[model samples]
Target: MKSKKFILESRVKDRVGFQIERILENEKPHLSQGSNFLATIGLVEPFIGLYIKYSC
Candidate 1:
């Protein structure tokens, strides 16, 4: 049971990491150092929101 729970959690983590990586790759060209800070927040905000909504 514990192993099953760990597997599910790891899968979710991997999926989220993949999505963030894709977002970063697509946005990299258009972002500069100054705007890069906000871009990080923008990139993660929706995922956090969705995770909260679904995890509940």
Candidate 2:
């Protein structure tokens, strides 16, 4: 079986991972530079399955 870290690393190298990172990076500046709620929501939004599924 593949190790968990290896699996995670591989996933990060693939299309979905790259797209996700791209989305967040693009959106990051709009939220706010130094606010708690903005930061919280920004990170939380990506985990919804629909977002990931539709985003790519």
Per-prediction TM-score: 0.55, 0.36
> Which segments of candidate 2 are over 4 A away from where they belong?
1-13, 33-56
Please report the candidate that would top TM-score against the real structure.
Answer: 1
- Clash pairs, candidate 1, are none
Residue 56 shift from truth in candidate 1, angstroms:
64
- Candidate 1 C-alpha lDDT tens digits along 1-56: 99999999999999999999999999887776568788899999999999999999
- Top candidate by lDDT: 1
* Candidate 2 per-residue lDDT over residues 1-56, each given as its tens digit: 56998898787789787899899999899766668887888888878867789899
Evaluate residue 2 in candidate 2 and report its C-alpha lDDT on the 0 to 100 scale.
Answer: 65
RMSD of each: 17.7, 17.3
Quote the positional error of residue 4 for candidate 2 in Å. Answer: 20
